[model samples]
Target: MVSFKFIHTADLHLDSQFKGISGLSDGIRSFLRESTFTSLDRLVELAVSEQVDFMVISGDVYDAQDSSLQAQLRFYEALDRLGKHGIGVYVIHGNHDPLDSPRMKTGKREHVHVFGPEFEQVTAYRRQDQRAAAVIGGISYPTAKVIENTSLRFQRDKDNSLFHIALLHANIDGDPAHETYSPCTQQDLIASGYDYWALGHIHKRQILHELPHIVYPGNIQGRSIRETGVKGCYVVQVAEDGGVNMRFHDLDTVRWFHETIPIDSIAGEEAFQTQVEERMQEISRECPGKMSIVRFVLTGRGSLHEKLEEGRIAVELLHELHRRAIRSASEPSGLAGLVWVESFDVRSGPWIDREALLKEDSFLGELLRYGQQAREDMTTRAEVLRSALNPLMANRELRMLLNETDDEECAGWLRRAEEMAVLLLAGEGGGESTDED
Candidate 1:
């Protein structure tokens, strides 16, 4: 039985900075731009060492609009490196890098064969001991927005004689919140005659099927907070007997990790600091990688409410997290390759308030209740707004605006809503002034 391995990956989003609220420093800016490429370099090394037969880059090699000439050149160089070792690279353009986009460029790598905009079929021939084996079929995004179902193209390939495989990019009910790219259903993939389907566009790694073979290698690297955890690729092996095995490799230069440090039973700042330090240690233990960028989320109900209420305490906690990160970096601790604390988020809420808040007639109490209700309803005000606006924001332009705007813009929207409420209240002739009411 001839066993061969191939690396499957997508959504590099190279040369894009982390979409952080705060401004990025020079170091981080460079890190963000170079990290994905670095990870790809590592992936190539791993593939060569592992003697992978071929590599499949499902899609999104760069950020949608910001793919640069240099990035293209560097990508070609990596492909050429693989080609030098007799490794063939098969690829298809994803939503971010559709076929018609002039900005996207493919370097001069004869060994690399990228599928065009249309749903094309290509046969991969392996000649061993005068015997030939073939795997056929691949798909691509024709335009930026593909509303129609694309998986229909793969259905006929299911029962083909040669081992059939499909390379596709879509948001398969896996993430309903994401833009409905190619709007495919899982059932379509299952019914397809193809033995394996290599998917892209979703940035989180997942395996959908084992019987007829369906897999998403996920993004090569996580570009922002929205894309988290150990970002990487997949290695799939197909044997002559039609047996398949799949495995994922973490190739991120800087790992983005979300850690929830519960402040439930914690006390003073000293104890808090200890708890945080211990939590950091635990994270390092869990993800033993290089240059880890963490978002430490202080959660749960506890005495932290009072401490967190004090702005100084909050600031101190942030400083302390950085301090611990620095110390961990300087010393040879279990942090291993942990490099920085990209940012820290504290989702703290007041469990107890002034007696006035409990009184329904009290204004301060009403405000507190409203705020708590919003929090209780959704994790954060942003989440609430996202849910409320999701339907309207389904429009690409509106979604882009929402993604680019911040809390200030959201506040303006809230103010407009409040004004409308006030006008309605006045029309009802409630006779109570907003100030007095």
Candidate 2:
């Protein structure tokens, strides 16, 4: 019964630029730029503190086409720290950091072993006895577009006595959000007969399988609002009985949060503002000792909806929220108690009985019927819209923006469209009594 422990992490994306983030304060922007490095530093600190047998970084170590010298140096320094502590490091380059990319002049330490473009194996040892603890097999992406099923290439070691772990940066079964690089499936991984599969290339942490422990520790830090919540790695311990235990450790210096505040019941401008402040305070308590970027969605029917719809009110509310965040940051604790509102969306509708509006034989009813039809036949409508918009999206710049627009963005646009239709139709003076005037 050989027991050993190791840290599994990937998608460091060092020095990566954040997307969809603009008009931030200079201090926050600088903090965001340094977040990746800070996350990697914490990972190294964790590794050293845990004194694990070895650390395996599945891929995407850095995020530039030409790897920045600062990122490379910072990475090397962190590895050197692990080397100093006699902890071994195993790494494979993902799409962001391909094998052909410009190499760093400062060489890696002896304890560090980077898998090459082809499938390779490295035997990690128990630090004290130098006994073979685990056999790690992995392959680095030679270029960014290696769409082959690299997982099938992995062959289990003949010596079944030592624990076998496979490291890869791949999109399993084609996740639409990510590029299909080194594509493979769960069956492919399971059939490979590896004791553990440490996966990368996906920003969200997931456990694809549990029997053999196929896992993605996710990126070390969230770069955008899309990558929300706590981002970190996993510490996996293999027991003497061949059972595997894994635990997640949060390493993000700054967190991203998306919160929805239902303002349906709240009345009056002052009360609404107070509610917003209370929500911010609640988030501040939840994410204590961490700076958070929050996207607050104000939803549900309420009297304040019309007030919020006014451009000036929204602007004033945003300003107030910003001031609150700045004031919190200026406290003795600094950024730790901060909660910056990256954006606020007013999605509330007028406090009208929607069912009664639909029952009326008026323009509002017709509009509601059209909306219902569109939703009921969503697939067909989506296809029609996609076909119509294909020409516009064909332009490179337009395509880039379209690509950045996730499902949430598309939904938001649809919601706004619906609201606009409702507002226009409901304004008709001839409509029968749908609600109080």
User: Which tens-of-lDDT digit does each residue in 302-361 have in candidate 1?
Assistant: 766556645576576666666655565556553455545555565554343335334545
Runs in model 2 lying further than 4 Å from the true structure: 327-332, 356-363, 369-378, 387-396, 429-437
* Cα TM-score of candidate 1: 0.78
Residue clash pairs of candidate 2:
none
- Candidate lDDT values, in order: 0.69, 0.83
TM-score of each: 0.78, 0.92
Error of 1 at 158 (Å): 7.0
- Per-residue lDDT of 215-331 in model 2, one digit per residue for the tens? 999999998888999999999888887799998999998888888878788888788778777887898899887888888888998777777777677688788778766665656
- Report the Cα lDDT for residue 52, model 2: 89
